[model samples]
Target: MANVEFETLAALLEREGALPSDRALALLREATRTLSDVHAAAILHCDLSPATLLLSSDGRVLLAESALARRLGEARQPDTPATERIAAPLYYPPEAAQGLPLDARTDLFLLGATFYHAMTGAPPFDGEDPETRALQYIRHEVPPLEQRVPGTPVLLNVLMQKLLRRDPAERYQSAAELLEAVERTERMLQKRQEARRAPAAAGAAATDTPRHGKRPRARQSTAPAEAPAERPPTTRRAPAKAPLWQSKPLLYGGAAAALALATLIALLSRGGDSKPQATKPPEAPSTASAVAPANTPTATARKETPRPVVEPPKPKPKPKTSTAAPPREEDTPPKPQDPPEVTPRRWKAVQGAAAGTETYEEFLKRTKGIEVVDYEDYVVNWEYAGPYRDPACAEKCGPFDNEFPPEKPGEKPDWAPLPKGADAGRPWLFNFRNITQIAQVAADRAAIYLRTRVYSAIERDVQIWAGSDDSIKIWLNGQIVHSNRRDRAVRPDEDRKDVKLRQGWNDLMVKIGQGNGEWGFCLRFRTRDGEKVEELRADPAGK
Candidate 1:
């Protein structure tokens, strides 16, 4: 009921890190939907401040004293006690309410208001007091969403503006529509987050390796060259540095070479001592024995083993340095997925007047041929002459008094009887049946005419029923009126309402045709105010 209470709700949400409870949120959602669907004319919450909402154990719901609930014509007192109050009333501008019927769109505005308050710490239309806020809701324009929350999606902002439109028709037609827009905003936000993180992850990977690479290289380059020889003794003393053995490829290679040399020396000593002492000839043996002593078996073995050890050390160190390159390659992050292109689709006008197709290409072709009228809200209006010319059919074929009786049984008229003193004669009737003609204009712009004359000084009303696959426009007495192009059937009886009539002779013209489906027109008129004058009738024979 007060701003203080609204502040309290905010405090609670901040502390909890979420709305009061799922049940409360669900109740609010359902209530919002109900209000939008049934009372499209009413604004659910005239004052959308935090205090109007009550968060109970069950969840969050509107308080009875909330301006919206009161405006909705609820009978409950503001102070009435309840476990939960789910609905609020809304106030509508009298003119807008009278002109257009309320529908679900009205409630969507409230929902948006609710979301705005929840996300921002303030109401969308903040004011000094409840009365001021109500006035702002009625007259003052709410600030753009960016002003409230920076980086809001344009689509979301536009949707909120539409929901809060003064005219109900301009708002979303139902709660479902508003929900869809909300869901889309959520998806867009998710995609944006993904897009932002992709580049960040790649950059992080790029920076990581250089930081890690510098440390190891610095330690290795600063270490003493004699560090290798000291490593084996250090490993024997402390096993903790045993892992360092794998790192000392050069030291390991030297140790392997020393062990191989010792083995080769032992093998040669056994071979020489056991072999030729007895088999040598006197002069040959003397030289061979002297050579063997000079070149001892141990020394010969050491030379051969050292040669192989030197080669192994060289290749072993090369492979270790080569192995380091793969880690650097591994450290390089995989390429980031490219962000999807976000191309916004905007509404554009396709055709101009002059009986041309409204397709995008057709609209382009007629650029130089017709006048294009631009209306508010990006609506385009065009006019073109129809395709059909007057037909040369015989005029004087039917008698004026000829009445074809009803075809079925029990399909009687449902009209109120004439008042006591009223003088009522037979009603004048005209029927145009079984006619096929095509206008020169494209099918979307065809016009059919039913010409007739009326003789009366009194008030008269006429109704025209027409069906077309594409579109239809009806006019009486030169006034451009009654147009239907929606993707629904056009019923003559239900669609045509009462119209004023003029005295003396008059022409009733109806232009109807299939834009895409079967095309036909039907009309009926009755004199409500004046006496019918027989002399005023135009004779078809004379014409």
Candidate 2:
């Protein structure tokens, strides 16, 4: 089967208009159930909005774009502004916008905001601009759903109000509790609809009853007297007082007698007798008498020897026997197996000891056969510094203010030659290197520095492609080449800069800042013509 493409709930709302209360509640229940699972795992979806809620054609609801998710107890970086940390400020709760510590209820508030928009076709918090909208989340109360979209279910409106509560304590404490309320509201709406249809159905049934009852009586009165004889004595007996006009046998006999009397009178009149002798009219039985005898034999026969009801024979149970052949193994049903769980790829630590220090001759030997030095090949080794933080610095911190600053690129820092210690700086080698996954630092709200040296055979212009989780600044040969202070998820090639790589080894330094959630950065070098650079070598430990 081909994979199905899903559209976001935001797109659905735009094309089809706001969802009805029942439909909205059903989708909310599905979304909340998924949130409950995430909460159980001690994770929080820091970003929740209509654009992040995926809707499939098959009616499946899924949460997407979870790069902003953080651990339950994780706190935002003290130095990082809350505005830079949130993916969607319109959906952020008061506590989140204030840069305070968050829990499961933080996500619940966002979930409510997203669904409130799903039902009302607009976010609960509104302002003329993004800044104003974010402020609304902190300072203003959300307007009631029913007030915005009249005729919305009262229970649904009340539920939404609770979800959008300004204080975490007022909102549902857990996703489980929210899911239960959503389900209850859904059931109540269904019952109300069923109740509405009940009376209409009953009225229709009432009108049909009398119209149907007259049919059987009409069929019985007009039927021929012999009609009952066709059935077995045990099945039927003719009616005793069928109308005389309705009985065929009685009507036929009466007509014949009237004709005979007419003919006799005509003969007597022709003889001219003053007083004609009374003619005997043919005899005709009464309607009851005619119908009674026809049915009397059947009634008497029914009482004398009623037809026997032959009951169908009951099926006999098969006797258990060891002589029966056993089923073949191939014919037996296979047991069902669960689908394998797919885990997201995470950075793994490189193994094996570092190759001590290599001479300048060794670096040449390593690059002798290598024609091209792509981004990955250029990232062989790096010296990582503290997962540092300064609340006042935020995204504005520079090399001059940090603990250790290299005078120039490619040159070893003064701290590098210091005696080995826990806090001492040293070169770290990577067997499997992705610049973005280089340092798997435990802290989220902090900054880190990575410096490496690259040897180029000759001068050439190259394009640098870089991406970062939040903020990043790059230096080539101790000269700043690129800087982006805004926070965002890492997407390779999000930033590009052109620079010259002079002959011999040159220093390259990168400083990345993390606001919250995931943290990382990626860098690669491509020739001006978009081709990979050749005859280059990476030297992390200056020889």
Candidate 3:
């Protein structure tokens, strides 16, 4: 492999201060599209920060550092201690800080924070200590982008807010969706840049004419005699409609234009036989005579509008009439249309769908199979028991590894299944909710046992994904396959374990111990490659 060097976006920002809106937008679009690709492959860029964005000497923007990337729907490993998985607080999501299970949306939050830093040259939630920063993100809303940097585009500001939403459900559900939003904001940013440039360009061109030493009268004298009036009629009519109550200048200005047009036409008719002399000084007809030339029969024919009659003399006007009334008429009509030249309508903020509550089933349907684990697609039945409790056990300390059919109430000596509800006066229960709430077992600091007989067509290695409140332990065909003794809220697919299933029927059992609040567990199976297990059947009765 070649050692190619590149500058981190963080360093680039440090050297350049803050990026221009257009530059920031281009970089954001590229980074978002790259993230969309990563998500397409069922991967999550858990660590998205300015430091992870690289700018090549060739000017291409890239997302680098895949070390923190994890498979879609995967969560922090239970076997790994919490201390080893500490994330940089600046870029990690609120869910990560709270120890909740993560998915593709988690990365979207980080991406938003990273870009916030890119635009303002500082993290949205900044602190010297990781704990303080994490607390800030978890408990507080990020200040608006405009508040941090005045005059930031509103569309971009709103986008940053949506991406950094405290609730994952409020954020864009997929990278593709977020990419669409970014492209829209980028286009608006481009329109604003072009709008600002248009007026400056027009002003610059106007200034250049003065430097060329050509008076306004010289420009009028040089115009072709038969030149067409390309000016639109609306441009001329717009000024006449303005009321004097709006401004005294507008009323006086309209009257002055009418007088200028009348004076210009009369001069051309009387001066038809006279030749222009640059050395002659103006007397009573100073404004008109200064501009009239050696006029021809063409000048005498059309006297209605001053434009046609005055244009016939292509080269005689001099600097003496440069500030005359005729030049003022040409400038009046354009004032109405000037505002439209720098149109800011294209920079209007784009509105997005408002956030609302959504069911898990609705989410699955809307997102299709991407990023989320659809437990209902793979497994539909689970036989469960208990709200079993052992006086010797505390919160996460339970009879997870003890022998089945405990000698006493909630008692277990070693690794085995506990007594089924049928033997404990609670009888067995069943549900197909994907996530069995185990609400029937209402007691806190209790345990629930879930079992199902899974039939596979052939012997193969497969994966079982499970989640539970408080703590959970799983057994595959009487062998302990996975166990996580941590107190936390449940999320689907929090733990994935690979196990061998026999050619026929196999017993799958689960022990979930609850501490407080919600009590539930969800389980599903798939091929080792994370595909649906098409030839599997679930029987709560072990048929």
Candidate 4:
């Protein structure tokens, strides 16, 4: 009744030829479960009209008369068991009022009636009035399904007929059994379709090679004849007259001239019998002078034979002493050495005001590195000695104070007491919402000390955001609390459980860049309780 919408089952059946077998069975099962869970005695009355059965948007189940009973009858009269009874205003069968015991099969019969209408896009029993349909449901037999809707499966038709039997005992025993029969029939039909398609696909693949064979053979036959026809004309025009350099006779003549010159040189080299003039017996033919006959087959053998022995000249050593000295060894350079390491000084300063007669106004103007030394468990004393390491704080020096009120009315305020041995120096404090900047924070054993007050009571939980390029440690009171030595972003939100605050004043001390940034740090706090707090501005006047 709360903006409920209805869609007729007849429209769905007409659009999608028949309900898928699985979907139909699933609908029936879900309907049974819903009825069981609601403790409905039975879905006693049956309405078989095309418009009465409505399929829900999920397409899983039909919203039968139970939803109507709950909306119209039960909602109006909460105490009455209207959903259990078949009353006039809620639902119509007067016979159902006679107390016929209903069970799961009664609901299955109604589902069968819905299925019949869905398959045919029309009710099993055709009647304009509800009374007529009710009478038919009780007495008349459903018409043969195939006669009304041709091509309906024989199994489905028989199932519908069984469901419409006048006697409840003659119908399918339960919805589950009816659903099983429909599923078996659907599977058989699907298997048959797949069997028919398989052979068709194989035949298509078998015909593919023959279909492409003709083109390749036709190209091969025409290619050879075309190549010969294009080649003859190019060959005929190639030779006009050969160049002299390429003539065969000229080449042979040049080779003969070269051979004759070589023979003449060999004769001249064997100087004509010169031994007669000297009158000495002709020396035996020297081994170097032996020559082989041109036609001898032993000429190659002569060239390969070993000649008489000859010794090579040996290299002589120089005299032992020399005037010049040997070149001195080249001078070698020395290896470079590594640079020395610089160890950083830790935070040793205390937190609070310096000891002097200087006014609070003058103390605020001085920019110096202040040390916060923790003496007791809960107290941190601070002192400012001189300017910060930064060039901006050159010669400034004054007394620093964080105490609440002045000692006398309208008189200069007293400086907060410092822990013993805390030297006065420039104090570093950074403030921003979401932006980032750099500041030099120096201290001894303790980290850098930050002195600030929360203006308004933060009604909601908040986070203090802090980060540094080097090592950093944060303290709320004098206690050394959160530390991030890994040089990563610091989020107090992650440690929100550890942070505690009163309504008025809150102090934060952070030591960062221990040896690096002169212990530099940058931090801010933000609320995380889903509400933004109006933060107090930095008030030098209040101090």
Candidate 5:
């Protein structure tokens, strides 16, 4: 018995749905050779399906040659063949289903069905139940390739049809014939690809100038005052003309336009916040970073490997460009995160340690000097603080944990553009990707101050699940909705809370307490019956 271990092609197809044409062709090529070798041994492989053929990521195929094959007598015949019909109904041949005599062509029919499924994402007999599927394979005709998969190559489609013919006499007589057909189609495909690339490469080289890096400096003529009298006559290259697009005047104009466009884009992407962006501010005692501006990333918690920044050439008339201004930072485009489904909302968070009503009290009395927090209408961006004192208001502060929905925001610096790439280093919650998970300096105990406006198209019951290290407190639309202080490892939906969401936007905030080990929280919204809140959208433009 030929036994080999590898991922099965059927499993691969199910995982990836369907494969590209080139990859599918390569798989079929290996299958052809493996089947041909098995048939040459004068043994009929009665069972052939994607699952029976082991495949590898690096493009190798092995057929499971077990009870599937029977030894042939003289005249190349099986005296008593296996009649168990073990192949999948999707790939089962008509003769095999009817318990009729089978031969090499039996493998071809099953192989065709496999290829059909690989390219079309559906089996030849795609009926739901086993009985309906088996009957379809026995009687249904394979649809034309165009009908099932529009762009399949006609030659490959033709080969598949010939292999799938119901009559054994009409199908390819042996595996060797099918192999030849695959080889021919591959060659034609190779030629077509080369033909397509030939003109495209030439055209791009001629028209598309390389814009990857800096251009070369201009070379100046250094002819001496006295030329060599006996120098051999050399062709004097007439002063090489600059490319039309590279003329000094035109280059200057283009440079200015590009610089202005970049500045405009940067401002637009950051939103219309004009707050000062200090590199670092005086440290303050608070949860989250006390003095860090909204634009500032937690330098103590994370750091990216720095690259040398190079300034671009300035237009000739413009003053020398600033070497200190960041060059590489602007090049990194912001990634678009898909909004969470269940927790019909999104949040922006600041980190804190040992978060509780005391932290909230200090944040309120020390900073805002207010009793209640209306976070929805909160107007200022507060500097992040650790699980300590509020820097702005000092230790002499009051708590507002009871104020479920604070009437407004607390002490905060100027509102800067929303944090970009703040969640760079850490992994976000699986379902709630919009909310970033920030690491805390203290391992076991930390808290985050988060705020967001959650809107729903209709009023419905929404389930909220949160996981924390030690304890957690959440405020929904200004009401303290959830409070859990038991210490435990963080996991998704470790603590579930169900609440009713009114139609339109609702405010939500949370303070997660950390005691030891990994500390962070995950929150999301789902329906009453564990369905996603599909009608939810956060901060949508114009509702």
Candidate 6:
């Protein structure tokens, strides 16, 4: 195995006792959703313990040994309490004992349990004896997360409750669902923190506008002083009574929302107008923004609180006049609206690209696959099965080749259009945000195809760096360029080869094969000394 350049998450947590909830929340939420995406590709991660969740030195999460994670539809050994495979038994569901099918929900339960353990300093159903813990798990008898950790966010606590539910039907159906809640909670927490920094004097301006013509205004303290010291830090965060996303109902989209945008727009206008009394009392305290927290708490760091700030008086309102005057620059209230942040782009490869599984012994003669002719762009498929989302193979095959029944003649087989899968004539488009299991259904054999692209670039010395789980064969401009057949894990640029290209559109085709484990390939252009060959353009679809 190649040396992984990070430590386990458990080590980080052990090193860092308590972290600021936001820092910890962002890391956990993002990582959990990534694992969900992996499962969406039909891989099962039996090891969801903290040790398998690795943290890079710079604080990013990287999954290790996913190649070893079990594939869905593969037969698993019968289960016994002692024979169960999860490294940490406490992070699993009762289905392990009940002999029920494990799906994405299983991982959802584990993710919630992992977060609960991190926050409360104990597993949700901890006990002195293994028997007691298992019994509690089977009975759905874990303590509510909020009771264990008094200051936890309401959304998180409720989410954890649903996640740890004993009945799988009651749990989140997918990581996508869990991730939606996570992102909403993260944003709510951030918005609450920002709300805390609003100066108290700003309330006076709001108070001046009467909801009813005769409503009395709240009196601002003439002699302002610092806030009291004994307050709990969490008090500034208002009760998250409503999911803010609900405020913009149009996003949900229905006949009910025909009035939502217009109604919300009016409410916002009124909120901007003279009705501070209605808005100020429920206004979450804003003094917390006095200063930034000491540092972003990491897994190994203690949780840090913001220092209190002294509130400055907001400028008193100017007298109303018939002759309007231009508003003073400082007189403008800072908008509660925050600027949206941009996320960095990550690598994307199309997931389903399997042609058909070919028996290793018969692949040379029996298999119907692609062979490059002029190499401008051409896609070939099995004559019997045609292009299909699921493949029909002759024997047991790897997960990458397990989507369909083995090939059969005169058997009008069941087939469906490949979802976001490539089509014949048009090179199967295989673009996605991460490495994915492209296609499946053969065994002890090879399913081979070529991904040919026409590129426009200056005539120069260039290189192709590729990484694949299976050995890869590459042809550059109709010449035999490079071939390597070895068992290796998929990574960026596991191998590189120098190639020559013409100034006009140049041609390249890659032939990929399947190995026992996960199978796919990563290919990109780079200069001889190693710069992304950004000047080249490629149309793999030949359109």
Question: What are the clash counts of all predictions, listed in order?
Answer: 27, 2, 5, 32, 36, 29
User: Candidate 1 regions off by >4 Å?
Assistant: 1-103, 126-132, 199-543
All candidates: TM-score: 0.26, 0.37, 0.36, 0.28, 0.35, 0.37
Off by over 4 Å in 4: 1-59, 62-99, 200-543
Against the unseen true structure, what C-alpha lDDT does each candidate score? 0.43, 0.67, 0.67, 0.44, 0.59, 0.55
- RMSD from true fold, candidate 4: 29.2
Candidate 1 vs candidate 6: the lDDT winner is: 6
Which stretches of model 2 miss by more than 4 angstroms?
Answer: 82-85, 200-543
> What does each candidate score in C-alpha RMSD?
26.1, 30.4, 28.9, 29.2, 32.7, 35.3
Model 2, 1-543: lDDT tens per residue?
157779898898989998887788888998898889888998888888888888776677888867778888775655565423567857768887777778898889888988888888888866545654665576557889989899888888899899889989999999999988998888898899897878787888889878688889988888979986788786555667878787989888989999767754553333322322322233222332344455676545544442355456779767766566888977976565532233111101010112446443454455432222432433534566655655544342222234434433375543222111121231121211123333343344466677777777689898887777667788898788888876565576788899999998888887777654445666677788876565555555543
The digit string of per-residue lDDT tens for model 5 on 313-376 reads 6567744575456668559665556332332111212112223444333443343311111222
TM-score of model 3 (CA atoms): 0.36
Positional deviation of residue 297's Cα in model 4 after best superposition, in angstroms: 99
What does the lDDT read for residue 122 in candidate 3?
A: 83
lDDT at position 55, candidate 2: 78
**Model 6 per-residue lDDT tens digits across residues 283-353:** 31221111113222331132221112335677977767745887896797757563223211211110112
lDDT of 1 by residue, 1-543 (tens): 333332334455567543322222354454454444445554344333344545544333443344334334444344422212223323333222233322344445655666555655556664433433454455445567667777666766676677677666777766666656555655676687687878667887787676677888889888978877776565556445556556789788989999877764454454445455534434444544565675676556755775665665434355566666455655877565632233112113221212443544444343322111211111011111233322332111111111111112463322221111111231121111112123223332233333334333345554343343324455566664576644333344344545666665554444443322233333344333322112222211112
Residue-pair clash count for candidate 2? 2
